[model samples]
Target chain A: MQPTGSVRPGGRTARTKAAVTEALVAELLEVGYAGTTIERIAQRAGVAKTTVYRRWGSLAQLVVDAFADTAGAQVPLPDTGSLEGDLRELGRASIAMLRMPHLRAVFDVVVREAIHDPAARSALTEFFAARIANGAAIVERAVARGEAAEGTDPAEVIRMVGAPYYARAYITGEPLDPALADRTAAVIALAAREGLLLR
Target chain B: MQPTGSVRPGGRTARTKAAVTEALVAELLEVGYAGTTIERIAQRAGVAKTTVYRRWGSLAQLVVDAFADTAGAQVPLPDTGSLEGDLRELGRASIAMLRMPHLRAVFDVVVREAIHDPAARSALTEFFAARIANGAAIVERAVARGEAAEGTDPAEVIRMVGAPYYARAYITGEPLDPALADRTAAVIALAAREGLLLR
Candidate 1:
């Protein structure tokens, strides 16, 4: 997180976005998506309601921007010179991301919001498509390195890393400790190694 | 649905339970957990609210009963005489379960309700624990047949089968098409065969 004194090019605008994002984070952490609303965010952040609407426009946009701006947590893809290493590194990073109360709440809201909103549905779809494509690079690198099967479905391989953790955290109401990251990564690494994750 | 003519052991009591469970399913399908209430379910089912209260004390109880019903979906464990075959069969069954609109909604409500209610959380936990333990029988049989590794964690292997599908359906807001069952089952089967899913 850049210091408030730095101002960072966008100046007051960036600060406002950060402030609104923080408010969203707080609201979601306290009450979750069902209790959160545009009006509540405005009140919590002390920002004008019109300003929130003019800028973010909707819950999806607000959540996307907030997630993107959570202390500039755009983690770089790992290149640990091996598929297993990269996935384990990525798994650790994912666990760190999940450790953030606000980010996890944003994800929860997105899933819940998509249930009833078409825009959120599209957003959810595009978000995963883009991310899956981006993350597929690890498997692609592994294939080039002669580690994984040439025809392995890169997207499925990539998804396998996150499924166990997300299922426990979101669906099963289980505690998602860091150790589970190792377990999930081990399973995916083994599966991908065996060429069993082909599409 | 036992024909009204072939009354089961509980007779009128069983009828009442079935009717209440049906009401719950309808309520969840129509309005989700947040919108459903004892009042709505009683009104919809033509069963008295007091009856619902006296029989099932909480939303979690009603949901568990509903899920256990829905046409007596107590599927027998797959014993295809092999781990991969058993997993594939179980995967197909899971996909079929996911395809049920009312059952899916009941699961959705349980997840949502668990977030705000401790009783729902316990129900969710107990439901998974019982199901996972029961399903582990397949893996245990596989181990006995020397298909999977001896030390493979039966519960973890069982959890793997459901995690990928539930994550997509419940977390990523993705369409959990039937094809995914094969993909996930393949990964878990390979991992278990290779002893990677060992606790």
Candidate 2:
């Protein structure tokens, strides 16, 4: 029976894809990526196994898609009328994302796999490179607004803001904290004021 | 059948334990911690399998000992008449050690294992905490000498100096270049001069 004014088959497919994606992420968080399987995803999503296979070629592809799918729209660069405000907001948002337990687990799996898999490594690197560039753009905007000095290395500047969190997260195995975020932002802002990178 | 100057059979056994420890580290580098085994170590070191069991009760214990055996003395804080000189030397030495692929492989195994094993994680944390304290002592000495400002958060200061190279190694999956080390040292020195952190 045809329902009147029903959307096209493409809409149904898109819904299915979204359901499968969410299910994959949920399963990943629950069971970990190593323990996740296509069949399990099918069971969780209530979708046919064949449908999952026909859409994504492999489990790695599915996991990668699931990761990329969860990335939020770039946190709007804080334009609170000042560069420091903007940067502080950016740092807070970035730290918040890194602190997410589910995402951190996914990051752990993907990065561990990346050590042995060239393709995964490339994908992860490109993903971060773009994110770093997006962050640099915020710093550049600040410089344009005269909040930051001219010719600041935006990538390096952004790196400085994120470095402590990543170091804590991956090295010391400590949770990134809001207090750290504030201190880092303060340090970077001071460095920016002095144009510390410049000779 | 002891040679002249051999104390006793027990002394020979101690020699075997030292040989086994050295062999374990070499094998860990060659095949990673996961692939290493007590029997393989005995074969490689030409020690009886019982010797390994008698000294280290488990693989984890053996690995902990091997790691302890291999770690050199902490890089001495250079008071080369200047804080910059001291930190730069420390940075250079750290870069040299971390850049060693064999050491990094062993480190990667330990870190991954630490994620799943509480005992390993505790041991690993203790190792790093001690290392951090050692580095902090150098900064403290610098402050005492008036080369650096007093009340500098030495741990945080060291983090700032060392974070970039490690971020590259663990996060970016990039090589730690000598040029990058030079620039990082320069930045840390500049920040020190500006009293970025209280001594």
Candidate 3:
């Protein structure tokens, strides 16, 4: 699908946008965000620089859109009619996403830029929010199944279970580990079953 | 305190280390990490450059040491008899730490280096790991008091709760909000008690 902000008549159309985005992703993975430019993106995509600027406003926007496009496809949350099964599936998928080298490079650049660039930060947040929202929907389904408390907050749970993996990837500069994901899922599952502790 | 790998030499005790560390921190805050050199650190500390270099081999090492030194004397965790209270205490203290502009500038540089430089990434990891470990210890105490689950991974929980705040601050170049910290603490507490939903 075409990005919301990237259409101008007689400019790069939906098809060219897709091709340009793919080209951008390849260049980003090869040269990183600092080296990947509109010129490079156009040459790689076999499109003109005018076509690129006509579609996306800046290199940053193109990078954000390309990253999102790469991460757009969502894995279906497992439905074994059990919360444990659901968590395991969700956790595993998250781990896999963090392990994608191309996406990880994009994520690294986005996060670094996010610290200083408002537009980049907004794009990163938007990307994360959408993914987490999808995970939350799956969790809400579990809550409705009576596997979890009615008061369960899927978004918060996503933060609880998935945040650590992201932290490890960014903070520690490590690929995601399935074992860690499993452990995190278990801990979150336990918390859902038992209420918060009190001294 | 002197870094773990450094050797203890003639006449310099804990107090001297503290003084030197303080000097280094001041310089780090005043000048960004890249700008803070061994010569500057020695001059600021009223010690010889050889002394500073003898202890820490590089500026990255010195910066890491300075960070550890500055973050050493945190407000002690409060025994509020509730998970929420304990977490709030940690959150407040953390926000206070992140608010120091000089420190924030250093942090921005360090995080950037972490993304691009292997040695810098290692130093940053070590720096972050200690803080995460300290936070876990506080959580563990709460767990022992039955204020949190015994199985609660304090390190993971800290990462989960800490991620968004840092993400926002890192990406937006903004200060952590006290209210957001409260919300994070509340969500973490809830997740600890009710368990998060995962489908």
State which candidate has the highest lDDT: 1
**Candidate DockQ scores, in order:** 0.45, 0.30, 0.22
Q: Each candidate's chain A: what TM-score?
A: 0.79, 0.81, 0.81
DockQ-best of 2 and 3 = 2
Task: Write one digit per residue (lDDT tens) for candidate 1, span B1-199.
Answer: 5333446667876777777788888877778776889998888878789888777787767886565454244568998887888888877887787778877788766665565556667767777777777888898888898888889999888888988787777656677788787777777888788888786
**By TM-score: ranked, best first:** 1, 2, 3
lDDT of each: 0.75, 0.69, 0.67
State the weakest 10-residue window (summed lDDT) of model 2 chain A.
Answer: A1-10
CAPRI rating of model 1: acceptable
| i-RMSD of all predictions | 2.3, 2.6, 4.9
The residue-by-residue lDDT of candidate 1 on A99-155, one tens digit each, is 787677886666655555556556666666666777888998888887887788998
Task: Specify the poorest-scoring 10-residue window by lDDT in model 1 chain A.
Answer: A66-75
Per-model TM-score versus the true fold: 0.81, 0.77, 0.66
- At residue B145, candidate 3 shows an lDDT of 71
Ranking by lDDT: 1, 2, 3
Pick by DockQ: which candidate is best? 1
Docking class of 2: acceptable
